[model samples]
Target chain A: MTTDDPSFSPPSFVPFERLCLIGLGLIGSSLGHATRRAGAAREIIGVDRHQPNGQKALEIGFIDTLAPDLETAVTGADLVILATPVGAFDAIGKAIGPHLSPGAIVSDVGSVKGVALDVLTPHLPAHIHLLPAHPVAGTENSGPEAGFASLFDGRWSILTPPEGSDPDALSRLTAFWEQLGATVEIMTAAHHDLVLAITSHIPHLIAYNIVGTAADLETVTKSEVIKFSAGGFRDFTRIAASDPDMWRDIFLSNKDAVLEMLGRFSEDLSVLQRAIRDGDGATLHDLFSRTRAIRREIIEAGQDAAAADFGRRPPSRADDSKF
Target chain B: MTTDDPSFSPPSFVPFERLCLIGLGLIGSSLGHATRRAGAAREIIGVDRHQPNGQKALEIGFIDTLAPDLETAVTGADLVILATPVGAFDAIGKAIGPHLSPGAIVSDVGSVKGVALDVLTPHLPAHIHLLPAHPVAGTENSGPEAGFASLFDGRWSILTPPEGSDPDALSRLTAFWEQLGATVEIMTAAHHDLVLAITSHIPHLIAYNIVGTAADLETVTKSEVIKFSAGGFRDFTRIAASDPDMWRDIFLSNKDAVLEMLGRFSEDLSVLQRAIRDGDGATLHDLFSRTRAIRREIIEAGQDAAAADFGRRPPSRADDSKF
Candidate 1:
């Protein structure tokens, strides 16, 4: 659907009467900017326990109004988003459930969907709708100030609606994302969690681990690590710079899946280490070749899939030259 | 130390009568091109065991002449650079030893200096001078065809010269790199190897290990690894994409230092893994905060140092938002 068509011109904005966004961190602030830009709501109010962050978000125009109390923010809101850290879900859900408007939809931007749904659903009001959502777009930078208006553009916004949900509301929510330049995808909460356990969750945990490992090398001077990082430590340093609280919650929430993946990664590493120890260059070469091919495949598929599209032309990994 | 006075520049256009480059890989080719562009060489000759790389270097204008035999390249050259893989230094030095010219300055671009000196010095003619060098700039990409003009811009090129070496030859080589837009630093061969083992060599080995580990995971599908790699794995892919031959030689030649560093790294990693298993959030947070401070320090130093200089900028760790 081209935006040039009169029908595709978004006839009119389907505005939520009141949208309560919890947390004033990077994701929440970006969502506040995105919703306002898409004109998806009449009033965008933010709820946070941190008084300074709530005040900062309002001052920076991330939200139209700031509410210090979570229950008060959800009192009459049509759409309530729990954008806090994944570990904070249960406490926030219990506090806001009783005050949610009838027929209002509650969603979240937590990374682990199955855990988020589990923590959120049991405490929610029976009259309200619980739709767990996760937008797979972020940087190491955090806080309200670190966010920008275009953070979600061309990225994946995964919605995991529980079975037997209202179809019309789902369609409306999907359309809302499409209008904001993000491609929306629907998946089961359990499947989404599993896929991300391999993709986003475990990778981040490993990155964090390696970075921690590099930081702990007391025998090697820190200056040396920074200087010749061109070899590989530079890459880990980037990941290690990720928002600490967000990643902390992710590992805590997806503990089982993360531990399982970590075990596999460790096993694979031991084999490679043994091959290197035994001077088996062929084994290392073969694995490197296979992984290089996989990198090429990813650059292609990511451009085709509406999810996490980097926009513009494809960046074939062919330009990757490791001297 | 600045190129501010164009009038006081070194004597212009002293083209070498004969210049021999032992390896036609990325660094050697870039030096060839820069030498040609600066009119510093009248005849640029390259030699490689594999005839194809030497031929490619000639075809790409990186070298004016090609030598299928190492002796043919070394016979009449005043400046002979052994730019082959570090592991191949012994074989190349033995092959070219008897053919060296009377006052030839034999230098190299190997990453590890101690190993290079160990292999090359014994085979060198007494009259021939040995100046071990390493250009600390490279991409993940390699080969003769991958060379570019600006690759050495703003990069550090360290020269590890032996005690009581010919001052005139050393001054000429330093002038050579300065003309190529690199800041030249002089240091001892052992110190250079130790510094690089911590910086370049260890980092490359770690990246290769982690990337190989992630790729060999049987439980997590390859497709999932590719999809979520935008989070942090992309950086690993870039680092892991470096030339296998170069890295293979790096580890083989610098075995002792790399093994020592690897021991340090593994010990540190075990401590971190224990902390994570014990759920020491405070410990994790403290480490994260310290790493952040280190990153800032590197940036500040680079920024401050390069403020007055023309081409010696910091590494690109700060460029990407994902990092």
Candidate 2:
């Protein structure tokens, strides 16, 4: 099913009779909204370590009910989605393992897939299926209030099922994401880790690092940086403002891939540094020009809006009310 | 003169009898629209080496008329603004020098102020005032058609006037930018370069470099990169898609400061890289959390709109026809 086709509906078969979401933050709450909108689940159960977030999710109408504990949440659920930071997967898997009903499908929306398999597989019961999924979409915002149903529209959702996984469970999860307005792809957990290392993890690391570097500069005060941020520094701040705990977990879990991509990035940056120091206009121009093409491809692929300024129009009357 | 006041009018003093804008691209054309909207200039003349751009600027009503050549553009103009790439300043200054009317105040909207002084000062006649300015605002879009009148609203316009320059001319230029809807500040050319190095130039360089690094990864194909960009890499792509020629000139012109800031960035990144390699979650979390505050400061200072997702709402019917 194509995500671009707004009229497309999920196959008549329901993926899960009862879906339990283990976290109620941005991704989890968004999933709840999408599934409820698509009628993809008969009942949606929300659980969060922070009780207030689960309450918020229930009040927001993304979930039909809120479970105070994992055992209660997963007791009769046919599908259990672990939607927290990657670092929490181990504990979550162990906690939900015994409570999960027989033949229940387990999935997650973590940024790193390889580590998800390593941490979750050992704890999960063999009778249940574990399909690791990464929905390549999000805003920097966090918590239930920050999520909207359309977050995954026209975005990719990659599912990485370990070898010897049940085919029926895998397709059911894929159908669930597609119904929620995402094009789905399947890949190995290892490859997903490497791809996201460069595309997501490393880019986030660089954004955080540069913002830190700019803030620490003795020559340019923090006020100056903020005042002049329209000159391009503000763009980095958006990505850097992402959930700190989530990113911290991603880096630690995907340590090897993150380090490899970081190494490549540093090497490439050093070359740029040298060119700048040596007054290499041609090198800078060529590199800058080539990167422009990638931006075009991304816009064409529908991964980004084609708007001139990332579609950041001046506030209208409605926007003022939001503030 | 508050930029936030949409109904603000320039304080009754017209800064220039006639304003000539050389190189009618994004910056130049935007200046034309702004000056015309604010009635800051009595007559605005557009000049571009690419004749179509001049014609487009006139058709768009951003300028009163189009001048066929640099000589004609500067002949009767009291204010001549060089809005070309910094690299072209030497040739432009030389071409327009002999024709510039005495007492004409010459200024530029180049990103690199120090180089603007170095390149344009030698070629211009001593009678004409050279007041270099950098308006710290723009989108990634280029060309005359991409210009908009409100681009400078709530943004900073930094002036880097040379020492011993006529105070009257400096103040006139400052008043012009202020009337065009920017808050004005004065600083040395050296200091401006250093400040922008961290805030604008280095951020752009890192953006360009990271996009390039992602595109060239052998394991991750370009298609995957594009598909998954929304995860984080797409933010960098917006900045990277900026006009290549302008960025090339900025890197070459502001080599010293860019290199220095880049050095600091590389060092900071190296430390982060080490932390990640050693699985240092605290460092990553601390840095990521600190940067979030900078984003807050920028939004509070009115440098960025506080709308979630950089104010990118899904296109309503009003935005459809914009394409």
Candidate 3:
């Protein structure tokens, strides 16, 4: 069902009778909205450790009901998604394991898939299907208020099912993500972690590190950094502003792959540092030119907008009020 | 004058009799458009090593005429602005030094201010005032076609005048930048380089390095890198795609400050790498949380839009046609 097809209707295919989201932050709340819009489930249940977030999701009209606890949330649900920080997965897996209904498909929207499998698989029942999926889309903001139904539109959702997993559960989860406007890809949990290490995790780590470096500089004041940020610093700050707890968990959970990529990044950076110090314009120019091709491919793949400045509407007094 | 004030008029204050823009690329063409709109100069003469670019700038109506050479462009002009890659400034300064009218305020829109002063100071006659400035604003896209009048609106224009410079020339250049909708700040060229090294130069170098590392990975194919880029990697690519020649010049010209900042960045990154390797979530979380405040401050200072994803409009089938 292509998103552009006018005759397409989501109510015809309800994969799960009830869908329970265990966290109501940006990704969780967005899932709630998209799930409801796609009619992938007959009922949507939202649960958050912070009660107000669940209340906000309910008021937003995406979730039909709010669950008080994880055990209660998983009870009677055919599909239960763990959507909190990856660090919380181990304890959460144990807490909700006994309460998950038989034949339930357990998945997550976590950034790191390898860790999800390691922490969650031992706790879940053999009868339950554990499918770890990551939707590679998000904003810098957090909480229920930061979500919208279109968050996953045209984004990639990778599902990593362990060996000997049920085929029916795999297709069912794939269908759910596709209905919510994501293109799905299946890969091994190990490969997912490796791929994401370079594409997502390392980039975020660099952004955070650079922002920290700028702030700590005795020569350059924080105010100067902020004032002159448009020269390129401001872009890094956006990703740096992402949920601290969520990112902290991602780094710790995907430790090996993150470290490997970080090492490579550092090595590459050292080369650049040497080139700059020696005034090697030829080396710097070639690298900078080659990188531009990747940006073009991403735009052509419909992964990002081709417009300048990410198509941000230029700020004006009139435009400020609209925001 | 505030950008929001409807009563503001441009023709009331003309700062220069003839505005000679010595390079018809993005910044040069943009200066032409902005200067015309502000009525800050009586005429705009554009000169480019690439003749087609100068012709295009004239056709776009941002420039009143196209000059055949650097010497010809600065002849009889009261205001001469250099807008090419910083590396070209030395030769261009020498070429135009003989032709510039006495009492002309010669300035540039180069990113590196110290290099501008260092290279251009000895070539020009003392009768001509030399002022270097940098408008901390740009898009990744380059060339004359990418130029727009609003490029500098609400952005900071930093002016670095050498000691014993003419006050009238300084004030005139200041007024010209202000009329073009920039908030102007005066600083020493050395200080400007140091401030920009952390805030701008290091961020760009890091971006370039990360993109290069991602491209060179054997395990992760370039296709995978592009597909999953929206996760965080794509943002780095945008800045990495910036004009290679321009960036190469920036790194080479500002080598001392860039290397200084790169050293600190490497040191800071080592600490983060250690934290990740040891699974120290607390250290990671503390740094991540602190960086978010800087993003908030940038938005508050109007250096960037507060909207998520840099206020990029979400791509849809309908929006694709609009682009």
Among all candidates shown, the one with the greatest TM-score: 3
| Tens digit per residue, CA lDDT, model 3, A84-151 | 99989999999999999999999999999999999999999899999999998899999999988989
After superposition, the stretches of candidate 3 with alpha carbons farther than 4 Å from their true spots are A1-12, A313-323, B1-12, B313-323
Best by DockQ: 3
State which candidate, 1 or 2, has the greater lDDT.
2
Per model, the share of native interface contacts recovered reads 0.21, 0.75, 0.78
**What is each predicted model's overall lDDT from 0 to 1?**
0.70, 0.85, 0.87
**How would you order the candidates by TM-score, starting with the best?**
3, 2, 1
RMSD of 3: 4.6
Q: After best superposition, candidate 1 residue A246: deviation in angstroms? A: 1.8
Give candidate 3's error at residue B273 in angstroms: 0.4
DockQ measured for candidate 2: 0.53
Displacement of the residue B97 alpha carbon in candidate 3, Å: 0.9
Between prediction 2 and prediction 3, the one with superior lDDT is 3
Q: For all the candidates, what are their Cα RMSDs to the real structure?
A: 7.4, 4.7, 4.6
Q: Which residue runs does candidate 1 get wrong by more than 4 Å?
A: A1-15, A163-165, A210-219, A302-323, B1-17, B162-164, B303-323
